[model samples]
Target chain A: MSAIAAGVTGNNPALNIGIFAVFVAITLVVVFRASRNTKTAADYYAAGRAFTGPQNGIAISGDYLSAASFLGIAGAIALNGYDGFLYSIGFLVAWLVALLLVAELLRNTGKYTMGDVLAFRMRQRPVRAAAATSTLVVSFFYLLAQMAGAGGLVALLLGITNKTGQAVVIAAVGLIMIVYVLVGGMKGTTWVQIIKAALLITGALAMTIWVLAKFGFNLSSLLGGAVDAGGKTGEALLSPGKQYGATGTSKLDFLSLGLALVLGTAGLPHILMRFYTVPTAKEARRSVVWAIWLIGIFYLFTLVLGYGAGAIVGPEAIRAAPGKANSAAPLLAQALGGPVLLGLIAAVAFATILAVVAGLTITASASFAHDIYANIIKKDKLADKNAEVRVARITAVVIGIVAIVGGIVANGQNVAFLVALAFAVAASANLPTILYSLFWKRFNTSGALWSTYGGLVASIVLIVFSPAVSGKPATASTPSMIQGVDFHWFPLENPGIVSIPLAFFLGWLGTVLSKERRADKYAEMEVRALTGAGAEKATPH
Target chain B: MSTSHDPGTRPDPDEPDWAEVHGSAEFVELRRRLRRFVFPMTAVFLVWYLVYVLLADYAHGFMATKLVGDINVGLVLGLLQFVSTFVITSLYVRYADRKLDPLATSIRERVEGGAAK
Candidate 1:
């Protein structure tokens, strides 16, 4: 075990870089080819609505399953056992919310951005502005977390222990992401996601099979091995409370995190935007079903991979590694197939980060250009049709730079909370507004504005005041993001329990308080959303 | 696409009668069918999930009860969440295909095809 642990830490940098370079080269060619048809705003923003349901579903899985899902959850399970599995369940179950409630309806009504759906019935300008604000905020925080994860991941895989090397790697990732969005637009980015999702799932599946084979294809034996390897806390690892059951407040915190995880995905801008890439509402529904299956299967693989790492590589070795829990999968790869498998899995992890960040950049830039600039600033009267696409490209570049800088500044910090915070903001700010706009006839501009801004502010303020940001001290297993600071008033690390209900209430209150009733517009939106009566047509180039 | 609608006045001749369609028995039935499936399903799953979470958080001994060799209630319940999700998705897909899609398709064609004329 010690020998294998040393071998994992001493991974061959050249082989890892070589595998990753080949992946980048092939994806770049694919992006360039896809860019040839990028002509219209619809093409740039929604991939000309050309992809099939299955294709878009794979891409959605790619976008939805980030390095956090691939690396972080695997690490969490490896260390904390059943507690880590909770995240996987939360994430997978969240897709049910997306499928049952929002997926088809959003596709039937909106064109490119969430703003289009929200502004369909209400005052267009204020609603679009507010939607754009939340979209950018959610995308930016998500981007920061992904970018920072890239640095830490490369540090683990390539043995780049120096800060300068990690920063350069982050900048390079940001540059590649910007190029993917700027050149290929939505079409290019979607293809990258599809490819990456395929690779990630295949890699995980291979490791799962390999690990199971080692234990004679018996899950019980594998579980027993994990329990034996866990030592004194072996029984605790098989159950819950290892991570989230220490105290009453900690139990409440678990509930809060569960709420955020389950409700947040349906409101995510990038995930919402993927629904537009399919032509029909049925196709959108199909894509979501597809995503649920692919995502569900991949998460199952994480279960095996996590425990496989625990049983084979042992927990103590995992903790001693540089990236700690996050290094479990790669170390397992080394233990199973030496440097060659580690290199391949490492490339897949890198591709996961790249695909996710590229997806986010496109969503954020599209929101800015479409909702904020084209609709609000230009008032839907753009003389040049291609100007929106151009603006989106420029916005992508600007966002890439911002993400690179943020990643550098936040590198090596505990940015896991940022992703959770992103989910909180999405659930609180975006979901209620979307639900109201789609379902409620009396939903107006005041309601949209109130829910969006209210939810955004409430979630962010609560996160800032929560223990995640300041009060918590570094423990033996986990380190606080900010040390020696103890000013937190909020008890729970996640604010979803408070913020989501508040946003829903505020939306209702704002509508009743205002005299802005547009029953005719509501009728139009309802007919369109339910029956697909004036939904955007597929303009495949 | 146009947002400027005078509430009391008739819509443009070229535009489909959205208000009329919205009030039609077909549209009303379609919406009812969707709500009937989704709303109840949503409530069921959310409650089911909350129970599982509460068990994991509070019912430590019960969750830790060993079912087999190293298999426990907590792990089984966690995997059941996955099963329930897949089941709900397949059920919704089947329901929509059989009951909802045909009705929605007819209404959409009526509105869009009428607008074209």
Candidate 2:
């Protein structure tokens, strides 16, 4: 039957490739046109700080609502009800921190990256270097997840080979992203994000309403049916018992997942950089209000989609793609309707990957071009507007290539794990420095550097040693290398709890050890920054 | 940073004295209140996050500690994470309106006035 259907379709894999190419071409054209007026470093990194409140706000949410949120969370909920909702709740609540604490403050103080904030009251070299390194690391890890997700979706949706297809998809997405950032700069990136976010939320919400209507709006009945299908542990659907439920474990997985989602949101570098595009702190705060509303509704729809997938498609399909569980949403769309809906969902999924990767790539590029190369290594010598833009485009290509390599290396991994690792790094490296810089008077360059380094080192070390990083023989599956090591020792699949606090401590200590310079040059710079007086004195190249 | 002649805004290059250019005491006080509010709010949210994790881990013991049919203290606490987020955010905004907003406005006015002169 499968062969017959395949023969009837005359399944040309090139059609799928062509379909992807058309979108990439359209995106590049849009971005290239947008870049025509991009003139300065600020324009390249922050779109000349010209984004209106609503536009930037939507873009912020767009950059944030990745394939992980669209597919991973929904699939999780479909497979494990309340627990999955826990991820959504944790993710949404972290925005309160963003709205109230981080967004306005980041806008009021910094120019481009988290490094700008930390480097504000410190020397240029360490601050810029540290910031660029952190941005690259976070962006690279994030790109890995997006690439993994694209590969999985292509294989499932387009029937492209999982191995080679993954690489091709990763390269295509990376290319689209590079073109976007290189041409449109921040402006192009922001617009792409806004458009993709709108499509994703609308698509998810539409699919969700359709699912609920099918189930007769009976939440309990739907869940109960899923639970039955889940079998002995009742872990198949709507609850945690079927497979992911704690067998003898003490619910540590639950705690870790919760921490990663909640704390991780506040720490993301790409998301943090979005605030810089807006003109004012007030706009920054207002935009988040819109984001919160949009994100809440979007997540609510995910719950329906998850439950719908479980009740309709059953648990067996989900099990068949455990490592690629995030594919459940698109798969459910395919199963419920015809190929058109499936293609639309697939297109939406591809766009989601492209938009997110663009944000990450641009952020990483800005850190390299603006912060490290021009500002630190060159000591702000290439302050000419045109020169900076040229440098930015070159850096964008370089960062894209590096990310392509990283994604290829980390191929076949779980998308959720890659996302978690990115969050872990962000929470450790970026969050501590940002919070301390804005609030703490004693915070100095030394402190910021130590915090950045400490967080980066700790998270990297822990992740490297964790079972997720273990290179056990594929058939063994039992983590055969564990002579004295096991996943249980760490509890969570990702380690934010230990790393975040350690970073904070290092930052605080760095400040204390450094000599106090009251009303110093750095503090004066801070005064100018907060008041917008800094921009008046010298043009941001 | 550009030399704009728009009155009652933009800092004047001639004004070297920051104290004279600074906003009124009301503005300074608002800034202080804002800082104060942020500190406690951050602490409270941190605690709330930790409590969610703790309860989720040990909730099996208390899942049966019910208030109604199947809805127990554990379940309530689990959901309360969402509640506390809204509560804290609302409180932060209210505090800002009462304390921070006026001062911010005052500072803006002073800064603009200084620039015009």
Candidate 3:
């Protein structure tokens, strides 16, 4: 390992550079080809609903395994041990909700965007506007996380120091996603998702196998060695150990993270959109079952990678790295496997960033184009198919540019923190509206609008006030009120628990207060939506 | 292109509507039972998840207080979160199969059934 590092670290930056260029070129070719077939609005937004169950299932997993899973979980496992594994476990379990309640039903009802499901029974313009707003916010925050990770990966791989390099990668990715969606539409996006998913899973599995073999196939001893090597802090390198800070912080951190992953997975817009790719509701349900198996297999491998890093690189080395303790996966790939393997892994990591960011950009565009523009702005009265497709393509480009700028500004923050904030917003804004609209017959349009806005505002406000966002030190020496609000009152780093229920409450309250007769409206829409035969009514209200 | 169908073949009623009505009292009772089951089951699972999270956060003394081989109470509680998720999901599936599915089938029958006349 040392010999390979000595040989490659300073002398072969050119090799890594050449390999990275090839990856970008390949991605460019795929996106270009995909755009050729993107001729109509249906092709651009829904891929004409042509995906098979297994193909869409693989795509769903690709969408879920962002930089957060490939990089974040591996790093967490390296630093925090069992807690890291817990994150993957919680993530997989959330699929049960998706499988049983959401995936099939969503495919059966909506043409595009989550808001369509919520707005099917309500006034068109207000519902579309609310849904579009939620989509943009959720996608923007998620995009920021991926772009930040892209910047980090580029800097680490190319040996560049100036932070402007990070912004460059973000812009390049934003451009790729924009062009892909504009030209190739859903077909191109699905193929990219499939390829990227394969690359990520293969890279993770290969690293896990190599790391395990390094310990002579002895699992128990490897864990023991890691714990001992973690030093006299007596922190169990295999266990979660004492709460991270202030004696009780670890427990709160663990619970909040657990809640976010389990509930938040069902709420993600891009993940939800994958369900719309299938031909039927039953196919959508079948696709989710396949996703469960694929995710389960990948997460089991993450555990090995974490343990391997802990055993091989040691916890002290992980802590010493610049930026984060969670970057152990990439560093370990470099340490155990030579630069060739590391290059391969880095390429996979880059592909992951591209695939996930592209999915988010597309979903946001669909929300804006299909739901807000065609439905709300035009009142579902678009006369020309060609014009509608053109509008969607334009929206895709605009969303991509907005995300790139956000990513550049959020350069120095933790990617995981941004991702958690996105989850909080999703659970607050999207999940409540979706769950209520599907199950509750009493839920009115006023209720959906108020709750969505209420949840979106509340989660954002709470997150901005939390200590995680406070840019100041926890100690008194660096304390000052930014604006007039004190940060101490908002203790939890994530606000999902507080914000999600609040959205539900607002929805219920709004419905009760308005007393609008929406049951008949929804009943008709629901029947048609479930049956898929009625020509869509000219946008409701 | 043939551009036509048999003139004597009348349109099947189910072709337009997609389902048949089954409005027997037995079916209505079954629908009510399914809703009753799903509501309570969802309520129980949600409560269980909340209690698990709250106990982990607020009741630290118990978690920090160790058990065997430095395997503290907190680790056990945390792992239980995974267990609870699977348990809830399995219960949901079972409820759907036994109750929700049949009720939904009945509702579809009512909507599609010619007997609605």
Q: Largest lDDT belongs to which candidate?
A: 1
Q: Which scores greater on TM-score, model 2 or model 3?
A: 2
Candidate 3: residue A97 Cα off by (Å): 2.1
Per-residue accuracy of model 2 over A306-399 as CA lDDT, tens digit each? 8677767665666565333565686677666656566667777788888998898888877777787767666665545576667768888987
Tens digits of lDDT, candidate 3, A331-450: 688787767776777677777887888898888888877777777777666777577677777877887888788777766555456788888888888888888887677888899998
Per-residue error (Å), model 1, residue B16: 0.7
Clashing pairs in 2: A230-A236, A235-A241, A235-A242, A536-B1, B8-B112
Q: What TM-score does chain A of model 1 get?
A: 0.99
The C-alpha RMSD of each candidate to the native structure, in angstroms, is 2.1, 4.6, 6.1
The runs of at least 3 residues in candidate 1 whose Cα sits more than 4 Å from the true structure, single-residue gaps closed, are: A1-3, B1-12
Q: What order do you get sorting by TM-score, best first?
A: 1, 2, 3
DockQ of each: 0.69, 0.26, 0.14
| Window of ten residues with lowest summed lDDT in model 2 chain B | B1-10
The 10 consecutive residues of candidate 1 chain B with the worst lDDT sum are: B1-10
Give the Cα error of residue A154 in candidate 3, in Å: 1.6
Residue A213, candidate 2: how far off, in angstroms? 0.8
Docking class of 1: medium
In model 3 chain A, which range of ten residues has the least summed lDDT? A532-541
